[model samples]
Target: MSSTLVVGKVVCITGSSRGIGRACAIEFAKHGATGLVLHYFGDDETTKEIQTLKQEIEGTYSPAKVTTIPGDIADPKTATTIINAGVSAFGRIDVLVSNAGICPFAEFLTMPQATWERTRQVNLDGSFYVTQAAANQMKNQTPQGGSIIGISSISALVGGEYQCHYTPTKAAILSLMQSCAVALGKYNIRANALLPGTIATDINKEDLSDDAKREGMIKRTCLGRLGQPDDLAGPAVFLASDLAKYVTGASLLVDGGLFVNLQ
Candidate 1:
């Protein structure tokens, strides 16, 4: 039903070579997106995975279209390259997911200046660059509208120990999304943020490898388990689809009630 409704829509996802971005790409394809632009930084394995994912989806669904573009989100030129790739390959971008992010954990007092700057550049500046490019492209399209999804973290809402540098950037992302949503709504474009809590990905699993740390995370979650990538895929699709047509400048939490439980 939802997939059928989204047929022929073009969705572009950045940092899609792995993790939540990868999962969102596959999920959108399954839901009848006309074409997909999978953006990766420098991971060749992720590029190969995108190819494989395209083939696998095509095998099960008709008109399964997918394309891959590799670039650094921190570079403004690379953002332009990604948008150009999507427009050239798919004609128009119906949805843009700004999902590329990095977190260098350290206490504020001991944090290196370079580390803080890199986090802000990638997490905050990258979002702005990609959103600007995508919005421009969306404005020129026939439908005169598009959806922008910023992948933020629960850290954006609450401060975490040893993550001072990372959380501030995420908070900035939410503010950016809200401002974009208000400004772009007049153009029929919408922007929103998705905040995921403690998902068990390679980035988050470093501590989970320790039983004590892992158990502490599980206990803090109301659901009594860690989050999986798939948990985020559905919500992302909904935001991009017409189902959330009126939902803009809002933040959706997909953390299995971790935020509330922690409170």
Candidate 2:
């Protein structure tokens, strides 16, 4: 009964420079992940914080190898690159946390085509490519098994006021996760989705800026406040670790009962 969750496991987390992605990377390392592939996207000048963050995680956790991988998730090849980098550095990829996503609040009628297309490309298409790459590796590897964690949102289950285009992408991921679970189960690959509620991340700061909009979410939540990045760290690690070996095609909500209390 070793309490460590993912000891000696190799994890790859996309969008790991900040926010929830960063939290997951740290959580896995703390829980005994031996290797980490931190995937990030930026101006290509080489993001310094990503490197600093990697150093801090590896130093704090000690004995874990952390590699920074930069690329655009929108590009199909980016998924291939991230997975390949992980395998090349760690010999194999044990878990993949597809946490890179975007939520641009926009009115349905006013939403530009570019906005819709980019959202589809990054949140849906990119996720599909990454999950496919990870699943294929898991299927062919000697161990013949691995876990895929798709970072979905509560918006997938419930409609949002301004997530007209964004919601669909998240919803698609849930469906995609289920499909992967069914198709890859024979290969021992587990696919699951995590639906986080209104989290206080820099990515959503503008969306939650309005006092009225912020309080509306608070009223629906069972917890008095919004969710923090740390709140999801536990759930993320559990899904990637042996503790959840039997779980697959499940969408676990880390949303303080917000969906349950939906009006």
Candidate 3:
């Protein structure tokens, strides 16, 4: 679909301070999302990034529109505040991307209860809170609906060596997307999950810097290359736009055929 089709639509992206979230926000803006609610968590540095992005958008687009909201998605009140800021600033929310997540690797035997709780709080609980808030806003919109995109991981589907605590939260996200899709279909709001494989994000580079580890990752993938944040941006745009209006409760895998090839 053409980018013009999504013109004037507003999109709220959580955890957009960096990595995949940041890339998604930029891509959405490029694809005619008129308004952007850039949500960051506990970071002052992101303010500068947001400002830079806003300037870039303004320079590139006819009329750039962007708003930044800082909050912890784990808190329901904060999530509500994010939704309200989007509505108050942009008048409406056309798409909500629940991308706020934390993945701290740990062996099941050695993982502490606190670690598990923290992971779930940010990944699963945060996703639920944000989706709830966005769905409420979307239901009341003149268009009477919007798209909700959950940023899940391929770890949700298969096992990883040292991510027991993190994987389950992602698994919960998939279920959350399905539940929301079923419950909100009547309201015309679509909910779906985007499952990305080992993308070259900063979080992964720290551990995968070794050649052996990097080689192993590439060997496992049918595409023979690690995924990039930009690689998944188009799919996200598609899901958010009218192009995927009939799609809901489905998990779209952007994993370079790794899962299928492994199976």
**TM-scores of the models, in the given order?**
0.95, 0.96, 0.95
Top lDDT prediction, candidate number = 2
Return the candidate ranking by TM-score, descending.
2, 3, 1
lDDT, model 2, position 12: 90
Tens digit of per-residue lDDT, candidate 1, span 1-263: 33665678889888887789888877887788878888888677766777776677666666867777887788899889988998999899999999998876678898889999888888889899999999999998997999999999999999888899889888998888899999999889999999999988866666679999899888998999999887888899999988999999999988888889847
In the predicted model 1, the residue pairs found to clash are none
* Candidate 2 lDDT, 72-107, residue by residue in tens: 899999999999999999988899999888888788
User: Stretches of candidate 2 above 4 Å error?
Assistant: 1-3, 44-46
State the lDDT at 130 in candidate 2: 91
Residue 244, candidate 1: C-alpha displacement in angstroms: 0.7
Better of 1 and 2 by lDDT: 2
Candidate 3 lDDT over residue span 1-42, tens digit each: 326656789999998877888888878878888899989885
